[model samples]
Target: MTAFGISAFGAYVPRLRLDRAIIADAHRWAMPGLRSAAKGSRAFANWDEDAITMAVEAARDALADRDLSKVAALRLASTSLPFADLQNAAIVARAIDAPHQIASSDVAGSQRAGTSALLQALKGTQAELVIGSDHPSAKPASVQELTF
Candidate 1:
């Protein structure tokens, strides 16, 4: 018999949202439609916030009742990592105080990075803490950016 379980899950949405009208006004674009008009309230990470910070906050919340010593691995997924060479997941693991021996990895470059990490976790390979987040950028007045 085998049992695979979700040890924890957490999310952190930013407090501030940039309205769609602001984007439209900034780009001098005419209002598109009701859906497009409402698309503007996209969340924004604070000046002090970054992928690592958001991951740490979510990890803290997810692992609040669990012992990090038991977290055999940590996986972070983000498209807005602060550095290209540095491993962002390692930073998050350290921030959350995971055991020194635990494995850590990062998945980046796309919005689906988090989903990919989750797939790995479900395989019961090594990851125990998988964190996925994105602060994806879009051109002002672009519909894609507005929705995200």
Candidate 2:
């Protein structure tokens, strides 16, 4: 049996961190409990950020000191994918200038997507790159907005 493992890894967080207090103040009347989470900040994706873009950024980070040619596959995991019918992993692979022969796939639909993709990648025959990102949009003054 062959052992599959991560040879290199990297991560990227959005520069913008929205203070939870802002959300609590904005909807304190509707959802008073939001104040409880006002101690920390949440990553805020830019207007142009989608799962593909963020995944590309993260992949670039991971590949910065490594050879892109060694990557055999690219897997993207996200719940807030921009396109419902498009190939997200392919886009990310292209944006990062990955080799044309590299296999690409997307894992989505739930929070488990990230972990599931990682597990799948670890079982693959070659070096696999798995990326996860989310850009959730929610209604104003709703608890969903505060949480997501």
Candidate 3:
């Protein structure tokens, strides 16, 4: 059997970071438990950045000094996609200037989206670009907001 493995890998982190302590302090009155978990900070995407943009960045990084024509497929995993009606992966593909015929898909809905896409990519025969990017937006004072 032919071997299929990752040849290159890359990641992108938003330049802006919001300290957890600030988040905790903002909602300390409602959730006192947040104070203890406020040691580090979390990456904050800029107003112009979204899951698609971040994925494109990471994909470009991974493709650096590499041939984009080799990519046969693209799988973007995210719980917070920008569009519901449009194909989000296609946007990433376009941003990265991938081949027009490349297969593109968006994996979402649950937390397992990223892992599932990775597994699929590993099992596929073609050269696949699997990207996991999420811009989590949660309600104020919620655990998700505090953690994400």
Worst 10 residues of 3 by lDDT: 139-148
Model 3, stretches more than 4 Å misplaced?
1-3
Q: Against the hidden true structure, what lDDT does model 2 obtain?
A: 0.85
- Against the reference, the lDDT scores of all candidates come to 0.78, 0.85, 0.91
Task: Give the per-residue lDDT digits (tens) of candidate 1, residues 4-92.
Answer: 76756888888888887677666654545434465437788888888788889988888887877767888899888887989888888
Model 1: residues >4 Å from true position, as ranges? 29-35, 125-127
Q: Would you list the clashing residue pairs of candidate 2?
A: none
Return the TM-score for candidate 2, rounded to 2 decimals.
0.88
Cα-based RMSD of candidate 1: 2.5
Candidate 2 vs candidate 3, TM-score winner: 3
What's model 2's lDDT at 117? 98
Q: Can you write out model 3's per-residue Cα lDDT over 101-145, one digit (the tens) per residue? A: 999999999999999999999988889999999998988877676
Clashing residue pair totals per candidate (backbone < 3 A): 1, 0, 0
Candidate 1 lowest-lDDT run of ten? 31-40
27-113 in candidate 2: lDDT tens per residue?
888888878767777787888887777788888988887888988888899998998888889988888889999999889988999
User: Where does candidate 2 stray beyond 4 Å?
Assistant: 1-3, 142-144
Q: Rank candidates, lDDT, best first.
A: 3, 2, 1
Return the clash pairs for model 1, or none. 20-40
